[model samples]
Target: MNWYQTWNNPLKNLLWWLVIIGMLGSLPLAYMRHETETSTKNVEFVFDYRDLLDIADLQTNPQKFVQDQLGKMKAAGIGSMAVYESTLAEFKESRRIDLYNSRDAAALTQTFGDPSENFTYLLFTNNEAQQKLEPLIQKTFADLGVGVKPWSFKNRSGLVIQMSPDDAAIKAMDPDPIAMQMLKDQGFQLVVRLSNHREFKSNDMDRLLKQLHDLGVKRIIVDGNEVPGYTEENTEENLNKMADLLNKYGMGLAAIELLKEPQKGFSTLAKQTNYNVVRLHSFTEKDGDKLTEPLKKSELEGRIQGVADRFVLAVKDRNIRMVFINGHAVKSLDRAKVVDPLSAYYESLTGTDGAIPRIEKFGFDLGPAQPFEVHTTSWQKVARVFLLIGGLSLVVLMLSFFIPEGTLIFFVLGLIGLVGVHVLSANLYAQGLALMTAISAPSVAVMLAIRTVRSGASAKWKSGIGFGLWLLLRTSLISLIGIVYEVALLNHITYSLVLQQFRGVGLLHLLPIAIAGLYLLFFSENNTYSEKLANIRRILSSYISVLWIVIAGVGLAAVYYYLSRTGNEGQASTVEKLFRSYLENTMGVRPRTKEFLVAHPIFVLGGYLAVRYRHAVYLLFIGVVGQLSLVDTFAHLHTPLHISLLRIFYGLVIGAILGLILCAAWEIVARSWKRWAKPQLLK
Candidate 1:
């Protein structure tokens, strides 16, 4: 019969259309249900654009900036804010600019910069109060003459900032001598040094220390050099001696002079001796060379924040309490010292005058901050729907057997409809359990019905057996094809590269083919006692193929593990290295290949022998092993090349072997059946 003739059979055509249409319609509903169910339970509020604001800049316009930020918070339904600062010098020194330049506006808003120029403000209220705050904050910013634009909004978490100090003006303010004296009088440790001019004699150092002591200054930082015209070595020795003298005097030493090179060794010594603070000199010529023109505020914040986080971690590790952050390299050590430009910029962007729409349009409210609440469906509802669909499919399957011949088409249609429902359930709800239950229950029912309908009469029994066998073979082939398709698709140059390139996602693409294999196995027929025994023998033979592939996988894993652990390249050949690399990159876990081979040599050898003989059971075993390895490998590894190549090779090898095996098995079964029938005929 032509393909069209078979497919166009009125009953078959109807079943096919029913199956296709049902599956197509159900998927979207299932996906929707799944998403709704998953989302309802844990509603988290994420900040929309966090990095856009630089806290350091907020010091320039604290009130206006904060009010503007408050407006965004009101719109987004954000309740709380956390603020941190990064040093200016680090910001200029780092690659934050590149990062900012590469990112889109949305990404640009996630990080904040230099806390010294900013202070965090959080708005708290019930949902109603929050709704009122957005417009109010916007108007407030407009009244202050700060151009407010909407930057981004979040439903739950948001950040805001306030004022910063002026750098140049603060730099001009010198320490008051009386104020210094008063601090000394209060028994506080005080260190004073000239901002410039490094040269000093040992006698000069002594006079300075003595003068400070007379003034009740308990601690002093002086030029490290003890004598003018001293050699570098002498200068170094003098500095060390001066440090020791300070310790002896029960005082702290702060080095005012910059070391020619910042030595890790000297830093270690200074740390050990509690020299507490070591000030770096002006930015080196090399540093100046590295600085780029037109420093972006976003880039500056990222670099600054990175340094701050690192410094915090380092200081915490060392148990250090106070560290002086220089204005030149570290920016502001205290928030009261510098303006945060980025924060002001962010406020301006997120203000009422901003280009972006109000937060409500984006499914959020801004103002009095409140806990986020997202609309979603309950899992119980999803479960009930699934149960209803499954029960209906089961009922249809049971009715198929007891019904008349003409009604078979209706039963088939119902089965197809159930399959459609399963697909729909999967797509809409993403509930694998529901879909599986729906699909499997109907399949089981159909098998049972077929078994029952064929049991009454001899002719009917013969026809049923033949049809069952054909169905088994068809299902098995289809399942094998699905497996091969999956494996072939996976074969690529690099699994990671493949994953990186993946953009399209279709509903049918996501289903696991292994489930199809299981379905085929469950529906397969073994009628007579001899036929059942033959099936068992075939299954046993298939184990041999599985054994061979398992041995290979284990062997490859062992070599990879040994190579990786020992870092010994010489032990493995190029081919072995390639294979090992593929396995390791494809499968995160390394298997013990050598050990497995040693442990199961008999099984491995038998499986290999069966493959050589083109045994169908062995081929099936090989395919299963390959499928399992591919699945496990894909699950663990990020690289696609290894996965793809391994899958393709596995499929091709297993498919070829299995095809031959099936042909041989069919021939053998046919011959045996014929011989048995002939004896019965002779009788």
Candidate 2:
């Protein structure tokens, strides 16, 4: 006789389907909002390819690693890569035991400078140190099979060796000419690093230009520690002459300046050239004691504005095509700052356009399982969708058979299905299927929530807004976990380092949630709204000792907060910056937004409700949203680090403490209200 059990109610079934539609609509809205802000700036990302270029990284399937990194760049729409140009160190070391056999260390140092001001002490004492260092050094070389032999690695660009006698010899290092050709052949622009200051001498200009032109190299990153053979006073004049020579060769010059004050030299150079890229290099110098302090937004913004004042506007006025804000992110937080609003502001000033990588347009075939294949399809094409619905429906009904009386099977089912689909959707067809799930799962949740609320046999079902929201919150948390895992795990992406392919939940990810909804609506126990709340309340209060329970929950939250961001000092600093940026984006200066007005209130209310009414799910739902946003915030791999780690601690621990306080406070109010009032709201 119950309404949920009645097979005759056609109206209730239709109502169930309507809520499902609303759920699907939220995704694309979320996706479009995060994809790109409308802008006209021609901003392109220039990533340092060191992690991919290490001698060790090269040996462990270099091609695959290249492909992986390439896929990441393509996904992020990266404009160019800064590649390391080897000097004749390998060639020099081939016949000698000394570091200086091939390298003009003093001459090179004049331009590029010692890596640090104090490196001279180490370098000058090398002869004395050699006696002590020789055995260990020789053992290392021998272990790596480098006895009196020039060492090199192969790639699409050919053989890149550690030692080459001269600039001309460097070209011969390319082994896979065809593979190396792929970089130029596929429209991948290059920004080669200039070795020492000598590479930019006026006399050597022609040779450098000819070689670069031949290799299709267009840009050069000048590491002018002090401009070799030229006084610091001639920096502007020399740069102007170099720019003119490069322009004649149809090449561009990039000047990288440290993130310091009075960038007069670089700013003067910017005012002089139109065919150029200027980078404000911000990095943590280990020796100079850089990035040791926590970053502040106001300070960072001031620095960005300083650079903007110096060159961002000038670069734009001159219509320069690219600008790089190059900073090394050795830590998670540092990486986050690298991609924050300050960086975005630079791009906004410059412009953003055509950053989507042309993966298929890449001239070389990167094998069949290429990660960049597009996966959309026309609606009329696939008739299997109807069959898929039936199949999923059947599976859900079957899966529901095993869930216990009180457990929410929908959450479990949805997580498994989405996680599996996300993991398994490797090919085109499966990708399409995954997309379908994303669109369909929201509607399914609406339907499930409505059906559960309309349980008893009646002419009209009860309004289930509260119950529906509870379902939404629960499934959303689970879905978030599954989707975050899929995107982060599949791409092997970390802190936007490897780059992520997708930034939002897709059909493949939604399939599991949809299946779980079906199980919850039709086959599960008929636990009503009152029953669910009572059970939840019991678990929070009388089910166990409240003080012990609060401590445990708070402890777990604190641990999750710490482990996720703390470990290595660099990592901790990095994560701190990352989380701070995330907070600023979500909670900063937003008085009317849902995150500020609703979820945060719900989070507090849920805590109070849990203490007073024993409803823990509501509080948990809000926390998970914050946690998930944390994932999706950095999910856009281009989002570099720039926040403090303490914000995360405040969010998790303080929120937990506040909840405990609210719970106690709510309990006191409920008791007073019951004692004084005729009609009670607490019960």
Candidate 3:
């Protein structure tokens, strides 16, 4: 005989294989799809721009600034750029001179007419234009002591110069007319800087515009950092006022404020005015020297991407034509003449002809650029845990099949293993484990029972009795174990010694009755016992299915009820009313009962059936009566009842009608199955 012939037939084997494979594949797919879809729908992204600004501030040191900025940008989901050596000494001195004089002056007077004649200028229009002006501005400002304050001159000539310490001295010396003429001869345009800290007056703003027009200041870049206590409304009003003045004077306002709180309003203004504003921070910056320890590139990318996303959203439709990203955002350059890679990426995304326009870079130090990628290896750890559990279950199952005595041992071990898994998975995979155990345990028990009973030596009454008793014992034990594990153990009930004592006492009373019942059932009838056992199995299966459906339906209904009742109006007071009505109809006597009956006719009729047919279908009728009593009790609690005694009696009558429906469904399924399975024909 072939090895396969010793076991199941070809058809049985094929059917078993198909069922197993289909269930295994389908269940995982269903569960995975549901989880994925739920997570995708529910997960939300929250962006905070302030945190990015703080991170950029922390990257003050040139060496670690780029790496630190990058790290923060990834974490905060925003991008920034910090321009290095952009502010020249002459610019700062001019600002201070204006600030000190404007605070006390009577009227706007030109201390130095055409101040642009004393400064170097560079205009950024196109790449070719920038290259052509770069060398010209560099040579013109070199060896020429632009007497202002401590200022460093670099390759770029649109110098962001600092404040002059000796403003009075420069005014006294009157700065050689020829040198002043040399600045004018070089086509220089002085861009005056304004501090946000200065209190704005309507008259002073008018004077400032006139002064800018006299000095040939074509653009005024406002320092956002200096702006104190500027609210959204204040900033908008100030910018609009400045825009009006600048429009009158044929000059434009360039903003360099912290793109933090007032960005939305600023963007709105930018859109309305068609003014382009450049951010002065990089994507990320870091501390510590690279030679000793380097920050993770993956971490930095995440930070940069976050900032970039925010920047894109904030100015996507703004009038801002371009953003000059700070070079320090990518890497630190000592010479302050290198381009930043992150700046280039921003430009690529939000510049002219780019995916998103109005972003560029004023690179102090730009370097080699790399492609962006996100790291998602955290999920691997969770996957490993699931794989381990599955592998262990398979190993135990396979081992059990190979060993004869091992079957029972392994069954016990599997139960223990599942208990351990339940405890462990509750923290890691609670719902998945719950669903797995719910489906697996019952299926496994049924399969094991069928296999054990089918291979029996004889279809004797003793065997049938033994099988039924064993099944009952197994079910009872499992239930007890479940209660202990789920409720007692979980609740910190550590009375194992007391439980053992109780079990010992209970066994004395239970053993004899159980033995006698087993013997009686065993000796009754072999064929009848088997038939009845099969029927009982079918009934049990149906009952379990029905119970599960009831549980799920009731649970869902309860959730809906809770949600519906929770908003503003307060929860419905149904539970108390139903309870009170149940007691009134069921326990009240004579006249009191008559009054209750007259008010609830359905309940009265149901009570009559429960009292009269207290045998065959009374249990079924009682269930219906109980349900109606609950509803009536809740109603009574919620509102004062104004019905007549006859109406009460009529409500009980309605309950009786529903009781009849319940009995009909029950009998139909029971009788239908019985008629279909004729034991005599099978015999």
Candidate 4:
């Protein structure tokens, strides 16, 4: 036995006490988080007005089609309409204006086309359109060094632009005030869309925003990858100006979920506005088409249901409070008709067990999403200091397993480094400490489980089940402390809203298992560190075999496969997805498959058999997966706290049950082997 194993090891006791203190200190922060999450339960459903116009343009009477769709959407509980900045092409599609090229204009007048002057012409549909658009067009074009002049087409007022049709088509125009007023009058909230295509001056932005604010617009979603004020010429300075205007108008931004990268100026704007942002999930036109392509009735219904399922997950699990839905017209060759998924989308929201009702059942109601009111308190900072020391202790505890005599040395150095990091960058310190705790707690838990199993190596069947269950509970509790420290340390609204993430997830996933494996091979089985080194040297000096090479290759492949399944982009098979859906429907929270099906079962049965067969200690390496997964579950900061808690509970209860079954089955197999197969093989 090592001197550190003595009962009076003061350093060991101090580390454990710090871990306990850290866990207790984090409880208040957890309660505060619960308060923050429950305060915002309103979910907004937004329809893409541009998408509606595009689909309407496909109909025989575009005006009638749009009115019908808007009424249907309002009936289907769409509370908001997302209106984009207009282009000339979009205006033509909306039937607000008619466009003619130079040749067409010349032909209409029965005059030859001018060889040197190719110009674009626009004819308003009515006097109202002419009054609203003509001056706006003239000023916009005049500012861009393009000439605009009054013209007449028969009895209608029109404008002539010196630029060609293509150039005129792409120019930026403000969102149509007529449409905005109509939608607002129709009882729809407007979510204005902004683009940075045109250079925005402070005064221009202020004017545009003031007009929208007067029309009762409360939120803006960007039209492209960059926010409205983000440009190559000026970065965050422009964002600050935009944020000031948004804040002045009492408006917020809708942060889109799962973008490949965040909008360039999003963080600056969000921070400047005190994080007046709500998470939005958008299902694009292409996504709708993918679900309905080669559309069979049964297939369409199933896929639509799939969309409802996703919306529910987004609201009830992730903190997505706004859903932006887009659709396109599809040509149905089988029926000889053009169709859009608008009705189908309506069904997904209004069906008996659809997203709306499901989300409401989870305590969300249909309304504008409220942003998190993040007000920091003095106590949270004090609590984090405790959490930091606890995290440092966990790192030292795990190190003690490998370097038994260096516990005090490691803890002192870790303390100094953590304090330095915290002073330099609190965010960096939080993430680093969170990662250390995440890796250390799981590795320490698995090591403790191995030691417990070793001490009970001579236990009988009567004690095995109870002993294994106790170990499972104890090890999980240790791993859960890592989660507590992680949550408390990084418990800012930015993490809850996913504006910042817990870094080093890849390292967190890999290190615990590797450490547990190292402990299993060298530190367990009553061997000293020097003796373990001798065994390694003796094995290296021995002959290399083909079987060993094959085993090494297989191990490397297994590691590769494990890593591929770790992050958000992990791939899953069709059958697995179906099985997951089944579990989600049947169980309120689906336990992770790796936990209940694989790791927990092995841990349980391995605990039982390790007493009888020393070789079974190796199973604890695989068992470390369940422990680390418990910690990793909370790393998804966007998932609701209660949902994460429920998920963890389900995983533990289900995993424990499955593990006992494996133990029972193994007992039966071993008895049968002893009775017949083992004796025969011995002969």
Model 2 lDDT tens row, 1-683: 45433432442343224323332322332233223211113444455544334421324464565566555555444546655543223222221122331334445334453343221011212233334333433333344343332221121111112322242233212112232345666566666655443434575556555666787666665544432223456665677776566667666445443233332343333334452433323222231123223458665444443333323222222222344433322323745432212233333233332112221121211211101111222321232332233223322322333332312344345446755664666333333333343333333333333333344221132422233234435434433322322222222211111211343342222333344444443333466656766755765586456897898899679646534532122134555445543443344311212233333345545533432232343243443334333233323332211221223333444444444455567668878877877365554
- lDDT on C-alpha atoms for all candidate structures: 0.34, 0.37, 0.33, 0.85
lDDT of 1: 0.34
Candidates 1 and 2 compared: the better one by lDDT is 2
Candidate RMSDs in order: 27.6, 22.6, 29.1, 2.3
> What is the TM-score ranking, best to worst?
4, 2, 1, 3
**Residue 426 lDDT in model 4?**
87
lDDT at 172 for candidate 2?
14
Candidate 4 lDDT trough over 10 residues, lowest sum? 1-10
Candidate 4's TM-score reads: 0.96
Clashes of 1: 68
> What lDDT tens digits, residue by residue, belong to model 1 across residues 1-683?
45544433454335334433433334343334223222211111112111223332334563355356545543532332211112212122121111112123234456654433332222322343234333433443344343433332355322231312122111211223333453344333444442213243455446545655565444333323322223455555655565555455545433322244332223432433453332212222223222222357775544333333322322222111222222111244443344333332233224332212222232323221111122223443443443334333333332332332333454556557756755775333223323332333323322332333233221233332243234333323323322222222222212211111222221122222233233234323435546656766787687557889899799779545534433112265666655654553344223323212221222222233332232322222223232222322322212222333444444443443444454456557768979897789888
lDDT of 4 by residue, 118-218 (tens): 79988999988888878778877887999888888789999999999998998997888889999999999999999888887899889999999999988
State the TM-score for model 2: 0.29
lDDT of 4 at 546: 100
Clashing pairs in 4: none
Indicate whether candidate 1 or candidate 3 has the larger lDDT: 1
lDDT, model 3, position 218 = 54
| Candidate with best lDDT | 4
Write down the TM-score of every candidate.
0.23, 0.29, 0.22, 0.96
| Candidate with the larger TM-score of 2 and 3 | 2
